[model samples]
Target: MSAHVRTPGWFTVNVLNRAVAWTARRGISVWGSRVLAVRGRTSGQWRTTPVNVLTVDGQQYLVAPRGHVQWTRNMRAAGGGELRLGRRVEVFSATEVADDDKAPLLRAYLRRWKAEVGVFFHGVGPESSDEELRRIAPDHPVFRITVTN
Candidate 1:
């Protein structure tokens, strides 16, 4: 199977994500929503975007359904970033998980966020077999989050 890399559409970028990000900024967590802030790799300035932070087994994760995006690249170079909700911000370091270890996390993420991000998964949902998820794991980067301070 090929990798799934989806760009956000007009509705997602302008309407849905904006609404969610706005609400989240007001301290309202719309299903673990937050504005992720990471320094741009080249620009060296903070770039922000709304993302769903998935917590599984007492650990938090950031999954990139869009695949190898700006934030993902930035996180790779920066090694850490912040998750903001309203006036609250949590600084954290991130480690990208190897593709082989992403199935469970991917499954959990899809189980929680399928309604919003399933389209990016290309028909692979939470119910997908481990093998199925493993095949597509390379496309979606999963990062384990550890709070810094």
Candidate 2:
């Protein structure tokens, strides 16, 4: 794959995603980390992607439902970027959290997502419990983005 895809799919995020981000900004939904808009590493275009965020002991972390994809790719590409929390902006560093820590981080995710998160855990049969999915995919990567502080 070339550095930049340049396809429409690569250029934009759909409305549903925008809504999640908006709600997060408004504190209406715990779904997005407000919005982490990273500059495209190659294209230099700004790309805003929704990510579920958590403040662990005052340090910030974000984890995606998807194991590895565009949003994650964008995060990896930038290494980090500006994180918008309400009216405040802070620089952040992106680190892919180790697999062994996925459980605790995912626990934070489950708390925030509740019923809304099932679709992402597709591997778990609808009847399967969260515990089941946790057991099955305990090694999935959870990316953590923390403020440079």
Candidate 3:
């Protein structure tokens, strides 16, 4: 049997989740998009979470803080969903970026979110993932959503 290390879930999650809440409240935005719409695999509930939208070469993506989080799961399950940027909502098909580009993407993500990443990383050093993100994520899977706007 393979053993999986569980993601950190103590005070760390509490704090980072608050940031997520903040983004959700203020309608946080990135790359001109303020929200990510991921559907529930089983229930088909359309869940929109305010996320740091990162774009690379014109491709839009959400670098999930926790890879194993439901958002990623749904992204994988659905492969395509909707994105709401202001009142414009459009459907997009998602594809997971392979590990080869993880480092580059991570660096781009850090650049777009250095302040929050600073708070998130704390003392993890520039070479490490923040505890919250590292908990369920460290090596992350990038959810690239194709957009035609």
Which candidate ranks first by lDDT, i.e. highest?
1
**TM-score computed on alpha carbons, candidate 2:** 0.68
Global lDDT scores for all candidate models: 0.91, 0.62, 0.62
Clashing pairs in 3: 7-135
| Residue 129 error, candidate 2, Å | 9.3
What does candidate 2's lDDT look like per residue over 70-135, in tens digits?
Answer: 666777788887766566666888898765555666666666664655455554533455576456
TM-score of 1: 0.95
How far residue 4's Cα lies from its native spot in candidate 1, in Å, is 5.1
lDDT of 3 by residue, 1-149 (tens): 11222354665557755556455456554434456777899899987665677887887777764445667778888897777655667778888876555556666776767665544433333356544334323445677778645
Clashes of 3: 1
Segments in model 3 whose C-alpha atoms lie over 4 Å from true places: 1-33, 118-138
Residue-level error in angstroms, candidate 2, position 56: 3.1
- Residue-pair clashes, model 1: 0
The reply for model 1, stretches above 4 Å from the true place, is 1-4
User: What is the alpha-carbon lDDT of model 2 when measured against the actual structure?
Assistant: 0.62
Q: How well does candidate 1 score on lDDT at residue 145?
A: 95
Ten contiguous residues with the weakest lDDT in model 1: 1-10
TM-score-superior candidate, 1 or 2: 1
